[model samples]
Target: MQRRLITSVLLGHYLSAFTALGIPLYLPRILSDLAPGTPGWAIGVLFVLPTLCTALAAPIWGRWADRNGCRLSLLRAHAGLFVGFLLAGFSPNLTVFVLALIIQGTFGGAMAASNAYLSTQFKGGDLSRALNWTQYSARLAMISGPILLGLLTAQGLGLDLYRYLAWLPLLAFVLILPLPKDAPKHGLASKKAEALGELPQDMPRLLAVQFLFSFAMVVTFPYFMPFGEQLGIGNDALIGVLYSLPHLVYLLALPWVQKHQGNLLLHGLALLAISNALQFWSVHAEPLFILRLLSGAGMLLSFVGLHRCLSQRSQKGSAGRLFGWFDSSGKWAGTAAGVAAALISQSFGIASPFLVACLAAMAAMVLARPLLMTSREIPA
Candidate 1:
C-alpha cells in the first residue's frame, strides 16, 4: 500500500511539473511575446504574484483538508493548476494573464497536499522515505521540465507550447482519484500538551530554519546567470549543466544519505555554508562546478534532515495543517529572497548574495541544533 501510494503521488507530481515550474521557467519569454512592453514592476508582479497567492492560500487549503480529507484537497489543488494554466495558455491580454496566475496560486498547492496526504499513512523513517521519494520526483522534474520547454522553443513552436501544456495537471487529478480517503481527526495534535495533543516543541524553530535555508539558497538564483557571465562562461549549455548538477547529486546520493542519517542537519549546514561562501571567489567554471556539486550534497542532507524532523513530529490528524504552514513558510522565504537578491545585487554586485547565504546557513546550524538533538530521541 505504501509503495503504491508513493508511486502514485510521484507520477502525479512528475506530470504536474509542466505547469508548476515549467511555466515559471519560461515566464519572461511568455510575457515578452504575449504582453509586450510590460513594465519592470509588472514583470516582478508576474513573477511574485502566484507565489504570494500560493503562500496565502496553502494554509486555508490545509485547514480545509483537515476537515474534509487530504485526497479531496489534493484533487482540488490539481484542478486549480489545470484551470490556471489553461487560462494563461489562452489568455487574451495582460489582465487575463494576471488573473490566471491569481487563480493558479489561489487553487494550486500539490506539493503540500501530497506531503500531507502521505503523512496520513506513515510516520518516522517510513514517512521520511516517502518524502524523499517526492524529492526525487521534484528534482527530476526540475531538471527535465525546463529542458523539455527549451527544446520545444528551439524547434520554433513558440509560446503556444505553454498554452498547450495547461492540460498537464489533469493527468495528476486523474491519478489521485484512486487513492484512499483520509478521514478527519479533530484536534489530533492540538495543544493538550501531551505527546499526542501538541506538536514538537521545536516546530516554530524548525519553520524559521526552513525560511533561512530557502532564503539563503534562493538568493543566488536570480543572479547566477550574470555571475556566470562575469566569469567569462557565456555558453548556455555549460551554465545549464552547472545549474542542473546539484539536482543530479540529489538523484544519486539521497538514498545513501537517508539510510545513514546522523547529525545530518549539522553537517549539511556546515558544508552548505562553506560551499555558498566559496562561490564568491570562483573565477572559472571548473571550481564553480565542483562547488555546485558540494552544494548539492549539502542540500540533500539538509533537506532530508529537515523533512525527517517534520515527519517525526507530525501527529496523525494534524499533518495537513502542519505541512500547509510549512509550505507557506518556504514560499514566503523564496519571495523575500528574490527581493533581497535584487536589492543586494543592485547595491553591492552579483556575488554578495552568496556571502549572505553563507551567513544564513551558519545561523541555521545554530538554530537547528536543538531540533536535531530532539529528532535523535525519536525512534527510527
Candidate 2:
C-alpha cells in the first residue's frame, strides 16, 4: 500500500516538472525573440508571478485536501495545469498568456497535496526516503524537461512552441489516469475559514530559514538567461543544457548523501549554503554550469531535509496541515524574492539580486539552528 501511494505521488511530480522547468527553458529565448516593442523583460517579470500564485493558492487547496484527500485535489489541480498550459500554447496576446500562467500556478498546487499524502502514508525511517523518491522523479523530469524542449526549439520548429509544449502535460494527464483514487475519507482538518492566528510556534523560525533558501534559489532562476546573455552565451538551446546541469547533480548525489549522512537536515543546510554562495561568483558561463551542479546538490539536500523535518515532527494525522504550511512558506518566500528581485534589478544592476541572495543565505545559516533541533524531534 505504501509503495503504491509513493508511485502515484512520483508520477504526479513528473507531470509538474514537465511544465515547470520546460517553460523556463524556452521563456528567456522566446522573450529575446518576441520583443515587438515591449522590451524583453516582460517574460522574466511574469515568471515570478506564477510561482507566487502557487504560494498563495497552496494553503487553500491544501486545507481542502486535508478535508477531502490528496487524491481528488491532485486531479483537480492537474486539470487546471492542463488547461493553463494548453491555453498558453495558443495565447493570442501576452495578456492572456500571462493570465494563463497565473491560473496554472493556482491550479498546480498539487505539490502541497502530495506532501500531505506522503506524510500520512509513510513513517520515521521510510518517510524521507519515500519523499526523496518523489523528489527523484521531479529531479529527473526537471533535468530532462529543459533539454527536450531545447531540442525541439533547435530543430527550427519554433513557431508555436507553447502550443507544442501543451502536449507534454496532456500526455501526463493521460498517464496519470490509471492511478487508483485515494480511498475516501470524510471531511477532516478543515479549520474555520476565519480562523487565522499567530502561525505555529515553530513557523517563524522555519519561515525565516525557508525565505533565505527561496531567495537563494529564485536568484538563480530568474536571472539565468539575462546572466547568460551578459556572458555572451546566446544560443537558446544552451539554456536547456544549462538548466539540466544542476538537476543532474541533484539526482546523482542526493541518494548517496542520504545513505551516508544520517543527519540529513544539517547536511542539507550546509550543502545548500555552499551552493547559494557559489552563485554569487557564478557569473562566468562555465563556472555557472558547475555552480548549477552544486546548486542541484544544495536543493536536494534542503528539499529532503525540510520535508524530513515536517514528516518526522508532525502530530498523528496532522501531517497534511503541517505540509500545507510547509508549502505555503515556500510560495510566500518565492513571492517576496520575486518582488525584491524586481526592485533590485530595476535599481542596482543585473547582478545585484544575486548579491542580495548571498546576503540572505548568510542569514539562513544563523536561523538553521532551531530548525535542526526541530527535525531531531520529528518521529522516524
Candidate with maximal lDDT: 1
Tens digits of per-residue lDDT for model 1 on 1-380? 76787788878877776568765777777788887888778788789898899999998888788767788888898889889888877888888888989998999988898888988877778888788878788888888888888778777654576467777789899988998988775545445422342445777899899999888778888888889888889798888788788889999998788887454878888888999989986776679988999899888888888888888788855677788888899899999999999999999988899999999999999999988767654444
Which runs in model 1 stand beyond 4 Å of their true positions?
186-198, 376-380
Candidate 2 per-residue lDDT, tens place, 1-380, comes to 55665775677667766767566646766555443455556755676767778887877776666556666666766677777877776776777778788988888765666666666666775777776776677778766776677788898644277666666556655545665654333454234422331235686687677767777777656666676777678886686567567667777887676564345555555665666566655656777777667667767777777666555565433445566667778778777777787788779866677677667666776787776765554434
- Measured over all alpha carbons after superposition, the RMSD of each candidate to the real structure, in angstroms, is 2.3, 4.4
Number of backbone collisions per candidate: 0, 7
The list of candidate 2 runs beyond 4 A from truth reads 28-41, 156-160, 170-200, 224-244, 274-296, 315-317, 342-354, 377-380
Candidate models: Cα lDDT each: 0.83, 0.67
Q: In terms of TM-score, how similar is model 1 to the real structure?
A: 0.94
